[model samples]
Target chain A: MRQRLMEATVDCLVELGWSGTTTTLVSRRAGVSRGAQLHHFPSKQALVVAAVEHLSDRRRDEMRRSAAHLPEEGRTRGVLEILAAQFVSPVFFAALELWVAARTDAELREAVAPLERRIGRETHAYAVELLGIDESQGDNRQLVQATLDLVRGLGLAASLSDDARRRSAVLDSWAAVLDHELEMP
Target chain B: MRQRLMEATVDCLVELGWSGTTTTLVSRRAGVSRGAQLHHFPSKQALVVAAVEHLSDRRRDEMRRSAAHLPEEGRTRGVLEILAAQFVSPVFFAALELWVAARTDAELREAVAPLERRIGRETHAYAVELLGIDESQGDNRQLVQATLDLVRGLGLAASLSDDARRRSAVLDSWAAVLDHELEMP
Candidate 1:
């Protein structure tokens, strides 16, 4: 029941954005009574906080799973492609909406901030593992972080455009960045 | 008179997003009569469109002027930093409100799309010139476009956060990508 409510919250968020997501709407969408929602989440903030945590946790788990399957001799571009695809997907957009919403609402921020820190640290650590690059010690860490940010920015921009060529352009740029990074002495 | 109104429109947008950028608000903020504003703009959409163009032009001019001051031996990074600083300022936030508002408003989209294309083209061209890279052929043009999109996304993400570290992280990531691109054989 809790899981079902959480799913409903994400659905409502994607369709309605932060302003439109409401307890009544979530209750109806989940097919759960208002009482059940209130039981689990005393307020709308509580519900949203729970939903963000659930979403962030799920995202982290998916990334970990993908990393686990990487080749022993991992290829940077291949790993990036997998991460990029996921980051550009609907699931991540749901998380993005929540993150954006958190900016104005303290409850949501409190719920999401720890997860955000975790994500940054985890991403940094993952780069160390996958690229065999130390994030704390050189200009390489800056490059890795930049590539991740470029991928992130590209993913969001691609989501907004109707142009396939533009989307392709973003990917090509990511590849170029990766190629450039690897060539560094 | 028209120039003052345009400036006021930008000021209102920076302070209040599209939903808050009504003609009445602009008039009040500009210290002009509603009749005067209406005579100039006729409608809120027209006013907003004009405001977007005004802001974009100013930003482009600022970019050009800033870039002009760079030493003849200025690296691409210096040019990009100036460009980045210009676009991430409060004036650019007004431009972004136009973008975010356009997502749900067709009229706004119609008003802003052409301007968006021009900006994209201009930025890409500028990047090529600043980075001393040839983009007339091959995938480099596309990479340039994607890099600009990354800047846009990072700028918006920075606006939504109070974290200077995150902002710097985003910029560092961008610098890293540029570093990679420059090193490409």
Candidate 2:
């Protein structure tokens, strides 16, 4: 029931933005009574918070699934492709919308902070694994963090633009980030 | 007087979103009489539209100024740096809130379309001049478009994470896009 409610939240988010989302609306969308919603979520804010956690868990699982096929020899390229696909996928747009909505609401921020930390940890860990680099190495760890950030930014840009060629270049450039020779400004 | 009104509109946006923006609020914030606001701009929508235009013009002018100082050899890098800086800057966040508000409102979209087109044109033109690549040329021109989109995404991510190092890598990777060997998998 909680999972169903969380899934319904994404459906509602796609249809109605943060301001438009209400407990009654969500209950109707979920085909559950108002009392049931209150029983499960306690409040509308609580519902959205659970939805955020749901989305984060989904992304983490998806990332791991995609990365499983990466060959050790071409791990860097493979990991980049997996990460790129995960971020740029159409399904993730709802999560992105929720994240954008979180900026204005303190309760949403509280819900999102842990998710962000988990994502950062997973992304950094993936990067270190792909690069075969030690995170304990000073600049190297920073490089991993920085590269993860770059991919996130590039992914967001690719999703928003109408230009296809530009989007492709962003993906390619992202793949190249793992190569040391590509680091020169 | 017009500038003062636009400044007030921006302030109003930072505090209140689309539903909250009104003639009364703008007049109050600007310390101008409703009569005076009517004298300069007849409607709240018109005032908001004009503010959008003002911001677009200001951004274009700033981009030009920043690019003008670039040494010939570093022109491409400098142009992108200026463009990326515009994203990470605090003023841009207020502008961003307005952009999101505009997304769901038809009047706002109609008003802001010209600004979006002009920015695309200017960015493409600057890329052509600075990179010495014709806009009509092959993927070379596409590379420029991609870099611009990437920067926009990077900027959005930076807003949430406050990670400057990641933002810099985004810009750096964009600079490296020219050298990437893109082949469709």
Candidate 3:
């Protein structure tokens, strides 16, 4: 029931955005009673925040599963593709709605900031692991960070429109650049 | 009065997000009468849509003015910094609020979609001009697009927290990467 409600909350966020998403809508979508929903999440903030955290965990798991199957040849491009896809997913959009809402809502900000930091740290670590880059070397850490930022920005553009063709080109170019930069001794 | 109202609308969007920003608040912030506010914008949608277009024009002009003073040496880094700064500005935040809002609001999406496409095109052109990149060359266009995406992503990270130090490092690394990539062939 908790999982269903959280998934529903994410769906509501993606479909209706932060402003239009409400507990009633979420409850109806989850097919959970209002009483049960309130018992689990007393406020909209609580519900949405929990939903994002849950979704992030799920997304990370998905990434890990996908990572295990990356092609031995052209693995860097494969990893870039995976990272780019993550940014365009419904989960990214749902979290984005909350991030924008949390900007002005202080209480929401308080709840979201730590979770975001944790997510960032984990994502960065994961990217580093996937790329097989030694961050202790010069600029590897910054390069990895830049790659994440690049994909994220591409994801944002995707959010606005279907820029997939251009996004693919950008990723290809970036993957080549990363290959060159990281391969340097 | 129209300019003041538009500016106030942007302020309200940045400080309050989309849902919290009201015509009444904009009028109060602009110190304009309710009658005058409605005379210019009959509805909240009209008001914000106009505000974003107004601010985007204003931001473009500001970018043009800033571009005039770029240093001859290390101009690529200078241009990257300027672009990065634009993404973190209140205008970006204001536009972002609308983008997130428009994702679910079909009416606002109809209004915002074209405006965003135009802005994206103009920004891309400006970056190409600033970097003096000949897009006729292989991968140049995609690289420029990636640069914009990278800064925008960095800007998004900045919105969540003061990631300036890490952002600077990422920008530095990207500048070096761009320098190398564009210098090729």
Judging by DockQ against the true structure, name the best candidate.
3
Candidate 3 per-residue C-alpha lDDT over A88-110 given as tens digits, one digit per residue, 9 for 90 to 100 = 99999999998888899888899
The CA lDDT at A48 in model 3 is 97
> Which 10 consecutive residues of model 2 chain A have the lowest summed lDDT?
A176-185
lDDT of 1 by residue, A1-185 (tens): 88889989888766655556799999998999998789889988778768866766676677778777777543665667665665666555666666655644566677777776676677666765766655565556766666666566666555445564666556655655665555333
TM-scores of chain B alone in all candidate structures, in the order given = 0.85, 0.80, 0.96
lDDT (10s digit) by residue, model 2, range A1-185: 77778878877764555666788888887888888789878977778767866776787687777677778665666766666565665435555665666655566767876776676687668767756676665356545554555456555544334344555565565455445433312
- Looking at model 2, the pairs that clash are none
Q: What DockQ, on C-alphas, does every prediction get?
A: 0.42, 0.28, 0.87
Model 3 DockQ class: high
Question: Which lDDT tens digits does candidate 1 get at residues B16-71?
Answer: 55556789888888888988889989998888778777777777777778777676
Clashes of 2: 0
Off by over 4 Å in 1: A68-74, A98-115, A162-165, A179-185, B1-5, B16-22, B38-46, B104-111, B137-139, B162-180, B183-185
lDDT of the candidates, in the order given: 0.68, 0.64, 0.90
Model 3 chain A: ten consecutive residues of lowest lDDT? A176-185
| Residue pairs that clash (backbone atoms under 3 angstroms), model 1 | A146-B173
TM-scores of chain A, one for each prediction:
0.79, 0.79, 0.97
